[model samples]
Structures are given as structure tokens and as C-alpha cells.
Target: MNFKELRDLFIREGAEFYNQEEASALFYRTLDQLLGWSRTKAVTSLDKYIEASDLPKYLEVLEKLKSGQPIQYIFQETWFYGFPFKVNSGVLIPRPETEELVHWIIETLKGQNGGSLLDIGTGSGCIAVALKKSLDGFQVSALDVSVDALEVAQYNAAMNKVVVNFIEADILAYSGTESFDLIVSNPPYIKEDEKPKMHENVLAHEPHRALFVSSENPLIFYKAIADFALVHLNPQGLLFFEINEYLGKETVEMLELKGFKRVTLKSDMQGKDRMVSCSI
Candidate 1:
């Protein structure tokens, strides 16, 4: 079928899962990947027929979309902080709120000459790589329990031409001699019971270990990371976390109770308390 027909098919079929605008955007994105055509080019070539060999690929993508698989997973890559990173079922897809957390960190440390920073549970290495790319002076390290996720993170670090120390260790049991001037984590904060509230794409495709905590101890990772930071953070070092919007008060209180000073909870663009910063 022609490009216009394919585009129409995407809009109509994708409507079951996404809004019209989102479906259209997805169409253009898939076209760009398959044909290397810009939006303008795709629009201009609407009447051009898709090659028979490429038709199956397009149909496959449509089927995956219908099945509620995230487009990012279908492509096995996504953009974050203006850089492209490889993603898969091994890691959680980087979200926009996490970008704001990165921005907050950069803004908080803009004029500093250099400092050490660690990203706990650095899925896909998006946070660590983005920080190292933006703040050239800072030494960045990332830790994750999943070796598969670290592999992807390592590839992304090299692909982005940024050096990040990748550590395959669980934060809950990690003991490190090195201290950092800053530590940040967007750890798993969603409780197990919250799974039902999440979209099918996330629940079915993303790594469960990277997205959930036991409902009995929803603050499990936060407590462990906070205690780790208390020991490994340099004097006056900063700690930041992208927290669950529903657990902002509890998280902030946990930090305060742990003896962290100047704990500040900040909301994302959506006005939900999604981040917190504190100093030792």
C-alpha cells in the first residue's frame, strides 16, 4: 500500500491504544526509522508505494502496538536528555520526570569545578551518561543489580562518548570505600500492589525488578540508598532522589529521620512531589 494508506492504517489501528496525535507521531517515527525519511519528506511522498519487503515490517510494528507493547521497546532505543540510548526489557524506559531530576542536579551544581557523582540503579545509564556529558568535570559512576541492564548502559556510555563507571551490584548490600560529592537515584518506588494502576506496556514489558518494591516495605530501596549515602557521601555532599509522587512525605521524612539536613522536596512540571534533595 501507499504511504498515505499506511499512515491511515496506523492512525486507525493505533487509536485503540493511543490518541490520534500520538498515533500520527508514532507513524512518522516508524517511517523515519524504516525509510530514513524526515517528516517533511514523508508528507511529500504520501502517494509513494511502500516496498513489498517493507510492508511486513510495518505490519509487525502495527501488531506490536495493538498488543500494547511500548514503541520504544519495539525500536529497542529511545531519546533521553537529547541523547539516544539503547533500551530493552532489561531496563525501565527513562521518563520525562527523570529528565527534570537531571536538570535540577545540573542546575544545583552548575558552577562547581568538579565533584564525584554516583547514580544508583542507573538503568540504561541515562542519568549517569547525561550528567557526564553535560558536566564534563564531574566523575560519574553508575550501579545496577542487573548485569543485562549494565550491559546496555555500558553500550550507551560508549555510544554517547561519555565515560561512566558501571558497577554491577545491588545497592541494598553494596559497601564501597569511595565517597561521592553527589549521589542520585531513580530507584524502584512503585509498590507491588500499585501494579494494577500502571499501563499494560510497563507491567508486561519493563523489568519488574526495576519498577517495583514490596507493598509491605514500599520504601525499601529508598531506605537502603539513604543509609548508603549517609556513609558514602562526602561531608556536605548532596543526595537526590526521584521519588514516587504518592510517597513524597514519607520519603522526605525518612531522609530527615536519617539525619540528612536541608531536605527539600520538589515537584515536577506536573506539580507532583517527584524529587527530593538533601545534604549531609
Candidate 2:
């Protein structure tokens, strides 16, 4: 089939699960991934025939997309903070909001010569790797509980040619003696009841441990990380979190009660309270 035929196939098939615009976008993205064609090229070469070998791969991707599997998982890769990282069902796909959080950290430490930073629950190691790549002379460490997730994270770090210390430990039970100049986390903050509001692809493909918390105790990870920061942060060290938009006030209050000073809640591009930064 030619490019137009392939595009028509994807749009028609993908429309069952997504709107026209999304389906079209998915078609172009698939073409880019499978054929290495830019959108401009795809448009200009609409009559170009898809190789027989490549057609089956496109069909398989369409089937998965129809099944509500995210394209990132279909390709086993994603771009974050302008850097590509490997992803799978074993780890959460890094979101654009998390990129804002990374940019925030980079901006805050822009002039600093060097400092140690820890990324808790570093699924895919996007934040740790991105920060390490951006910051010169900074020692970066990432901790995750899942061996599968850690393996992916480690591979991503090496793929990006950055060294990040990966630790396999549950943050709740971790008792490391190391201290850091800055600590950041984008831990699971979605309440159990909120799952129904999320897209089926995310709920189905993303790791639950990296996306959810009990509704009764939605801030569980935040509290634990805050307590850990209180003990392990250097004097006046900084702490940052990519938080749930709905629980910003409660999170800020909890941090304040825990003796974190200068607690500042910030919103993402969407104007929702999605990040917080503080120092102790």
C-alpha cells in the first residue's frame, strides 16, 4: 500500500478509539516511527508505496493502537526533555508535565557549579538522566523498587551517555545514609478513585505502582519522601516534587508541617498546581 492508503487505514482504524484529529496525528507519528518519514515527507510522498516488509509492521501497530496500547509502548521508546529514553509496561512513560518539572530544576540550579541530586522512584530514569545531562559536575542517583524498571532506567542512562547511580529499594523502607544537595520525585500520586478518570491506555499499560496511591492516603509517597528529605537533605538543601494537581494545598501544608521552609507550589503550562519546591 502507498502512503495515502496507509494513512487512510490508520485514520479509519484508529478512529474507533480516538477522535479524527488524534487518529490522524497517530497516523503521521506511526509513519514517522516505522518509515523514518517526517510529516512533510509523508505529505509530499503520499503516493510513495510502503515497502511490503514495512506494511505488516504498520498493520501490527494499528492493531495495538486499536487495543488501546500507547504508541510509546508500541515503539518501546519516547522523547523527554529533548532526549530519548526507552520505556515499557514495566515503567511509567515520562509525561510532558514531568519535563516542566525537569526544566524547573535546571532553571533553579542554572548557575550552580555542582551538587548532588537524588531522584526517587526513578521509573525510566528520565528526570535523573535529563538533569545529569543538563547540569555539569552534578552527581546524580536514582532509586526504584522494581527490578524491571531499574533495568530499563539503567539502560536509558547508558544510552544517554550519562552516569547515574541506580538503587533498588522501596523508598518507604529505604535507609540510606547518603545526603544530597537536592532531591526530586514525581512519585505515584493519583488516588485509587481517580483511575476511572484516566485514559484506558494509561490505566491498562502503565505500571500501577508508579501511578497510584490509596484514596484514603493519597499523599503517602509525598509524606515519606518529605520525611526522608528531612533526614538526608544537606543544610538548606532543596526538594522538588511533581505533584497531583488536586492535592497541591494539602501537599504544601504537609511539607510545611514537616518543617520544610519556603514551600512554593507551582503550576504547569495548564495552570494547574502540579509541582512544588522547598528547602530545609
Candidate 2 per-residue lDDT over residues 24-86, each given as its tens digit: 888899878877989998889989887897688889989999999999999999999999999
The digit string of per-residue lDDT tens for model 1 on 1-280 reads: 9999998999999887788898889999998888899999999999999889879999999999988888899999899999999999899999999999999999999899899999999989999999999995899999999999999999999999988988989899999888999999999999989888888777888999898999899999999999999999999999999999999999999999999999999999999999999999
Best by lDDT: 2
**In candidate 1, what residue range of length 10 has the lowest lDDT sum?**
195-204
Clashes of each: 0, 0
lDDT of 2 at 13: 86
The TM-score, computed over Cα atoms with residue i paired to residue i, of candidate 1 is 0.97
C-alpha lDDT score of every prediction, in listed order:
0.94, 0.94
Candidate 2 has an lDDT of 0.94
Stretches > 4 Å off in candidate 2: none
Q: Report the lDDT of model 1 for residue 11.
A: 92
| Winning model by TM-score | 2
lDDT over C-alpha atoms for residue 159 of model 1: 99
* Candidate 1 segments exceeding 4 Å error: none
